[model samples]
Target: MDTTLLHQYQLVLSSREALLNYCETIRPEHLAQPIPSYNNDSMGSLMRHVANTYLGWLLNFLQQEQHPYFTEDNHKNLPAIRSMFEQVNLVVNNFLQQYKDDLTAPLNLPREGETKLTLTPLELFTHVITHEYHHKGQLANMSRQLGYIPVDTDVIRD
Candidate 1:
């Protein structure tokens, strides 16, 4: 992997830590409360979904055993969600190490419907990180709707 990409990912992790730390200040119940407009998803569910996307794409490329997405009932709390992301981090590290020599080599996957899916390691990494940040925004909005003011979770902040 390029050192630049690794550095960028570290920045993303910094922002994620900021966001999770802020999430800890939210009411425990709010994390589990379903917000109907966002597909009735609770904040916890969105977090799990983000982790799942990382696992789904990267693990598939690694040809590693994959697990189903975490259930809201089982991982709706802060500690459990944090732990899930820990595992996600491990998987991400393994993926980067495995493809460090050639990040842009195409990885062809089993077809979905009529179209086969193909992506480079870099593309997969980019997708999962961006997906996390996208839903991180949603989590912030959910916190606002639940009556808590969100803090700055941007990649670079003063």
Candidate 2:
């Protein structure tokens, strides 16, 4: 892999691990608490969404397939948060192994009713990471509103 792709993947993996650890620390009851009305998503839902989003990106990367929007089924049920986390971790591991040989190839991302968008593998990797970070921020906010401390392991800080 090129230096940029390698760095982006490393950052993604590290951030994912950190986010999972943070989620693990949250009290079980708090997991079900609803986020504010503005978002209307429960903490559990947001967590599941983050995992599903990454999984969707991974599926695109490994299978070169187009997937639908994020959903609970895709996340293996956020109500069972631990299992969901395990599923996400498994997907990440599988993705790393499957794409080990093509880390430098450009990605083919298809959009609905639009031309396909192409990005370097490194760019796609970073896009997914940033996507995760975006949702993770919302999760952190929900956690804090629910009176829990959020994890501080951001890629920028790391």
Candidate 3:
């Protein structure tokens, strides 16, 4: 694998692991505590959404294997959320490995309306990485608001 692509995938995987570790520190009861000003998505829901984003994008957009995204409330609990993140990490990790050499191959994906967008595997993979990193920022903020410190998910850290 190219160093750059491997690094990108590593950051995504590490981000998921960081989130799982963060979940371990949270009180189960506080999993669903929502910051009203932030939005209706609680910590648990946000975690679930992050996992679902990986599944849905890979499946529906990137032509990967089909699997149901665990978006229901029951699957958004602390333990389940952690598991969902693992599942997502596994799928994406596999996808990245299997498609490493095809990174620049354009994908035939559709847009929301009648438009079409062709993206390289590299772009799709990057979207999944950036998407998780984006949520990790929100998760960090949410953690601080809830009186807990989120794991440092920065790709480069001491």
Candidate 4:
């Protein structure tokens, strides 16, 4: 992988760390509270969904493995969620190493009852990180709903 891409991913992780640290300050009940309007998605569930997207695309779809997705019951607390992201980091690192030679090589990913989805390694990486940021915004909004003022969790912050 290019050093630039690696550095960009590091910045992404740093922003994610900020979000997780903010989550640590929140009450467990607030993290677990279901927001009925948004399909009953709790903050924790959204975070897990982000992690699972990394696993689903990079690992399961890329490697053709059937890894089990994390459940709310199993990952009920911040530590468990952090650990899940640790696994995400590992998978991402492996992917970077594995595709260092051909980051732009196209991959035909399976789709249900449709044509296969084609993506390059770089595109896959971009997809996962962008997906995380999209949900990260939702998490901040969810925090506000639960009566907390969120800090800056972006890559460039004051």
TM-scores for the candidates: 0.92, 0.69, 0.84, 0.95
For 54-155, candidate 1 gives per-residue lDDT tens digits of 878877434556566667654679999899989888888777778888989988766547566788888888998999999999999999999999999999
lDDT of model 4 at residue 9? Answer: 87
Q: What is the lDDT of candidate 3?
A: 0.75
Candidate 1's C-alpha runs over 4 A off are 61-64
Tens digits of per-residue lDDT for model 4 on 30-101? 888898866888999989899999999998988898988878764588998899999899998888888888
lDDT per residue as tens, model 2, 1-158: 33544556577767767776787777766776666653767777777777677667777544665654455543333346556656666666666665667766777777769987777655555666687788778778888888888878687763
Model 1, residue 30: distance off in Å is: 0.4
* Tens-digit lDDT string for candidate 3 (54-108): 7888876677456876866645466777677667767777777877777888777
Instruction: Quote the positional error of residue 91 for candidate 1 in Å.
Output: 0.6
What is every candidate's alpha-carbon RMSD to the true fold?
1.7, 3.9, 2.3, 1.2
Give the candidate number with the greatest lDDT.
Answer: 4
Instruction: List lDDT for all candidates, in order.
Output: 0.84, 0.67, 0.75, 0.89
Candidate 3 RMSD to the real structure: 2.3
Q: Give the poorly placed runs of model 3, Cα more than 4 Å off.
A: 1-4, 64-66, 73-75
Which candidate leads in TM-score?
4
Error of 1 at 151 (Å): 0.6
